[model samples]
Target: MFKAVLSDSNILKTSFDAISSIVDEVQMKADSDGLRLDALDRSHITFVHLEFKSALFDVYQCDEPLKINVDTEELMKVLKRAKSEDIVELTVDEGNFILTFENEARRTFKIRLIDIEYEAPSPPELEYPTEFEIPFSLLKDSIQDISIVSDKIALIVDADKLIASAEGEFGDAKIEYLHGEKITENAKSVFSLEKIKEMLKADKFSETAVLKLGNDMPLNLSLKMVSEEGELTFLLAPRIESEE
Candidate 1:
């Protein structure tokens, strides 16, 4: 038997909530090191990779090393029932999984074990020419502010600022942040505002989010948790404009 506890449950919860909006099933690997999931969209364009260490959970238990795949939507449903202050404990018995989140009183949630076929795809391996860290809260806020006005927002990053703008039939919205040394770029790429908004519906965003972006590939957004914990990185493919 193995068990571990974490200081914050929202870390995992928030990660799950963000991606469940697009994909239903997600592949998860849980071991002594921690839990990890690399989920990609059907188009293979966008991906969300999450690494959670054993210490992040209030109670992490394992009889043996295991890799399990589950319906992310359903899994999130079970986790949502947990309170912020509750201690979460997971265990497997009789080919079934049980999750108990409790303080004084405990509530047991169980789901049957089912095999879900999954393929692990390699992330883009090219070296990104640009990398920088911005306050996670600011990035989250910028996404939200732009989403209200348009479904798609263009991200234009240079040496001095990160700008988000949208110019659709409904009009336009733009947010520009001036910080750091200015790099070189008069170019821009667009992304789904709704998707970014869905991604930031988490508990804490007080930390910085590192962004690695360049070329015509995907934009990587990485967030770091506490030590002994893992990070979550989201790769979003750029949306190309029609030449019409």
Candidate 2:
């Protein structure tokens, strides 16, 4: 037996919105610890991870561990109907995953679970030269700034600042946010601006994001709840430039 009740519907609404854009389906495992999911996008350009502790839920119970596998897009469609003030209950029968939203009125949706052999992906063990935290809006703004000139943005970090820069045939854009981290090494990596923007759709998840980067390596970005009850993270593969 496994079930959970969330006091706020926005938690699932915003998260799946971002997640659906990257992955078509996911296998979420719920245990006594809480609920967690890890999935790699079909193209393997991105890996996403999400964890919600029991503390994040109004009611959480698990007599035995269980897996809920479903289509991400279909789940997001149902989640979109949720209101901010609504409470959401999650459960699964043998063939269906169920969601019930309660507010002024109660609404229930049953989504058929897909049968597939699934192995939860694990985040690769990565070591970065530099890591720092910045406002979530900074990433959103930088994506806009860089997209004006190029489809790719190079992220660079020195002791003084974090930079997002891009250049195209017609123009170039650069954004610098002074990150007062006592970083000893300088690192840089280039990534797709479109992919970054896709991950930023969960703007309500966290106010700040932690970044980890190394030259020509995947970029690691993490969003955490201030209460430390939940986290959403992504590892985006870098775009490689061919040498002439």
The candidate that wins on TM-score is 2
Clashes of each: 9, 0
What would you estimate as the lDDT of candidate 1? 0.72
lDDT (tens digit, per residue) of candidate 1 on 1-244: 5455654567657877877765677767777777788888776666888888776665677667776667777778997887888877776666656777778798888766767765756566756766777888888788877777778878877778878787767667888877584566544667776566655654262277787766555778887875637787788887777866
Go through the candidates in order and give each one's C-alpha lDDT: 0.72, 0.92
lDDT of 2 by residue, 149-232 (tens): 999999999889999998899999999999999999999889998888889998889999999999899999999999999999
**Cα-based TM-score, every candidate:** 0.87, 0.98
Which residue pairs collide, candidate 1? 4-60, 5-57, 5-58, 6-57, 6-58, 159-181, 159-182, 159-183, 160-182
- Best candidate, lDDT: 2
Error of 2 at 88 (Å): 0.8
Instruction: Tell how far residue 186 is off in model 1, in angstroms.
Output: 6.3
